[model samples]
Target: MDAPISWAEARTAMHEAGRQGARPAVAVPLSETDGTTLAAPLTSRTDVPAFPASAVDGWAVRGPQPWIPEGRVLAGERPPALTRPGTCMEIATGAMVPEGTEAIVRLECAHHEHGRITGVARARRDWREAGEEVSAGEELLPAGSPVTPAVIGLAASSGHDTLHVHRPPSAAVLVFGDELKTAGLPGLGRIRDSLGPSVPSWLRRLGALPVEGPAHPVADTLEDHLAALTSALKTADIVCTTGGTMHGPADHLHPALRELGAEYLVDTVAVRPGSPMLAARLPGGKFVCGLPGNPQAALTALMTLTEPLIAGLTRRPLPSLRTVPVAEETIGRGDFTHLAAARLDTHGRAHTLGHAASSMLRGVAAGDGFVVVSPGGVVDAGMHVPFLPLPLYAGEAPVAVRQEGVPAVPLPDQAHAHSTAPR
Candidate 1:
């Protein structure tokens, strides 16, 4: 058997693969462009709101003056005559303030009378200044910037109709198995095709458009395996196949990959439960990642190797992992690093979850993240552990849930909470 590659080496290879050809382009309406990467920088032709707008439901007025209601000047309408001193104009939220207005005072701060407004109190500093939110000719959305809900709203506010964004990389997946059954279907000896649904959904989360190919039978013959791989790469920026990539009785992916002149980068990894992972780049420049058949192993490869590939294509920096303290002792085998699924409790303490077998997916799903045990000996409790975050759907950062009386070191970096997921 060939020697396996280390995690750092695999990551380096995968990241290098991300620097390939130009990504596809797409013109998406501003409303649907959230979470997409900008293909070019968007410059504001006009200031956001185009004029001074009221941030609160109040009266627009000049500074150091009492409000004297003369006539209403709602948003989108011209300011009433300022011929009289102490005159005020009523402005609604999101409404544009008329000319000569220097600031906005909340309605409650002024006294209302019959056809007159006065008795302004406690001056407000919260006026929406013109060109403050977005200036004319300013870079509205820079190229390579990922659009968030706030970004989309800001772009729309700046008068953008269509956004130029990098079209997400498309993927085709091939699952090799005769003993695998479709999800939610009855199975006797055959196992459920866990990779089929999980990999697609994961790819989508990673900002790639996933195409699921037909499942091929697990074969000992290299010819059968090569055909399956060839089909997957036909329309994919990257092809990911499950099983047969490692060194074993049915490891046909290695020989087939060699036949295609694929530049094999990492054939195996030093990580537990996912050591059989393989990565290669074809002559045409498309990348390939082969994951072990075990469900968790495939997930490990996806999170580790595949994410960098998508980041490279999309021109996004791969998110950094959060570092937290392990709440219990862990003994390492020294030959390989252990990526044990773990629960990060409310108190920020990371506890290793049992049933870390590569074949187990249920435990992985239940885990908040994973505790990485480097080659050596036991990882004692209360020791800090580095962990890769799972794809959490919530918009906010997850609060740590810690065991009672156990002190946990807070993860230093919380910026990893940001993601490319569509809001």
Candidate 2:
């Protein structure tokens, strides 16, 4: 068997593959730009607050206090200029401030009687100046920035009807294994298929647009694998296949890749539980990520390989790891790097969770992300370790962390003591 590459090397290799195969940018309406990556700098087409406007409901006064009343200026209307030195006009909030206005006297402070106005003007200017928030043609956000709700709002405010952004790469999941069942309880030498139903959700959170429909299942034969992969690659920029990564009799992933003339970018990674994960690029430039059959291991592969690949595909920089203190002593996997499922407390400490076996999903379901334990290293309590946060699923709330006064749980054993070869 070939030696496995380090986890970091595997991630880097897949990232480069994505960058080489990045999708072209397209102009999309501003209403549909959320979750896309910017292809060009988002520049303001017009000044924010295009005209000088009132910051409060007050009197637009010229030449100071005790001014004569003129007229009322409501929001959305262009008011006439305050030509006379002692004249004032009642102005509502957000109404354009007329030219020649010196200051604003708040409504409460002004007394109007006998068709005249008298009041003390506020110390601070009560009107917003044109282009005060943002000047026309200024870059609001740079290329590669993720289009968020705030970004969309800012784009609209700056007069952008549409934005040029990189279209999200589409992915397809191919589940392999003759012994896997799509539904019902696992029994009679057949287990329920987990990856088929879950992998698409993970891909979506990673910013990849998963092809519509449930994951396609492939039989454990070289011909079947080739057929399934060929079909998936036709529609998806990336194809994720679960199981069949090993060189066993039933494992056809490698043979299919060979027959398809795919180049191996990461044959395997040196990470516990997910060590057999592999990434390859087909001749057509689409990617293939081979995940282990184990549920937790498959998720780990998604983070280690698929996440960075999507980042590159969208022209985004590799996601940076956050450092947090360990809440308890944590063991490592000797030579292999360990990605321990963990929940982060409000205090910013990582509490490694239990039930983290390769096939178990309980730990990950309750955790915020994974805490990285470097090869051959043990992290003591209070020591800082790198954290890889899980992307938030659509409409999913953040995992609640332990609050003050909550008793800390003991650190559990590492997910697995030995590396799990691909099934």
Candidate 3:
């Protein structure tokens, strides 16, 4: 940490390291493949809809005639041929339309009887055509596509039994400092280990499987640091360490990293409160990130820097954030940008929270998300400020359980949430 490195410079360095580490070849089962990357392009073995079907609970009618009910066709049941004009078959939602029908008039808009029907309205034009959703032999999903719930459902509906997906990366977290204690356990003159709980959760959110640790605390010695770092590096695709990257009296990561021939991508960034973050690539094609030990600072670095590096390494596309109006003012100035924890009110406005120190996890804990307040200027109320939505686990209090089994809550339509800023 000789001088603060510019954010742009840090990003470039991390990007380069990410590129060098990008040889993803992990595979996983379909049961655990949600959000995993596709190894090859997915083409349709059969058409979506598979047949000409009704889009609504309506009567299937032949072309160019007034509606008349000939028979009833329930869903998944076939009907006889339409051999005469003005013949309409009652069809339920998702039922296959008769071979000669071109339009569907909903039951509400048509007059019906036991064996005959009439008086269909002119406005009932809701008919679903065959192959409208997917073609018979087209590419439904391209190779390298991340498997989402929608993609998996589509693939299953289109007759796929299994899919090839990139596996989650193995992550090893190492904590340095003999003074640290296991969470919730107390020892005299020792602090609880903050990085242990937080880092594993973050890695899990990034589609990585965190390897639980021996939780070794390195003394302020070069040999001690090297031994711990070497053990973690050998077992993980990525190794992240806490506390030792700093230049303070206890810092030993710099020397330990050098001993392992770790290439420095960026040792520091020009952002407030979390600039001491470091990214490096080990010689054996693994990544090692040195994160600050303060709870909030390390969390910010994970979201802003390490998350993107993980995405690049896994070949997953990073999400783009959009600008939203600020509900309050933010003060800062410089060439670098700041990711501040804030609440996005219901009306798409960002309200700044006061607790922003590197050690203050309360701001993030209470807020709905973070606002990316640029250092170039002060953002006023109603001004569009870019920000990121924190993970569902973060920015909220722990959930409670009732006596009975808790009902599953439906997720909100994230596509329409307007209060977010793009990455």
Between 1 and 2, whose lDDT is larger? Answer: 2
Model 1 TM-score relative to the real fold: 0.82
Worst 10 residues of 1 by lDDT: 414-423
Model 3 CA deviation exceeding 4 Å by range: 24-30, 39-46, 55-80, 84-93, 102-127, 136-145, 159-165, 185-188, 215-224, 318-321, 333-337, 373-382, 393-423
Q: TM-score per candidate, in order?
A: 0.82, 0.89, 0.76
Task: Report the lDDT tens digits of candidate 1 across residue range 1-423.
Answer: 468876656665676677564467788998777657788897887876576667788777664565566556666775654454466777888776766676666788766666556645346554567787788889865677666787787777777899888766788787776677775574678777788777877777766778867754445578887887787788888888887766677677888888999987678888787988988889888878898899899988886788777767776654455456777777664667667898888888888888788898878888977776665546667766557667655221112211234334322121111112111
Tens digits of per-residue lDDT for model 2 on 1-423?
Answer: 479987777777778778888878999999998789999999999988899999989899998556888899999998999998989999999999988999988889889888888988878888889899999999998898888788999999999999999878899999999999998899999999988998999998888889953344687889989888888888999999999988999999999999999888888888887988889988878899999999999999998899889988998766655456888888988778889999988887899999999999999999989888877868778777667788766512112211234322211123222222111
User: lDDT for every model?
Assistant: 0.71, 0.83, 0.69
Top candidate (TM-score):
2
Give one clash count per candidate, in the order shown: 16, 0, 7
Give the per-residue lDDT of model 3 (tens digit) for 6-94.
65455545655564566756545556667576766777778777877777887778755556667888778877877677788888888
Clashes of 1: 16
How big is the positional error of residue 318 in model 2, measured in Å on the Cα after superposition? 0.7
Candidate 1 local accuracy as lDDT?
Answer: 0.71
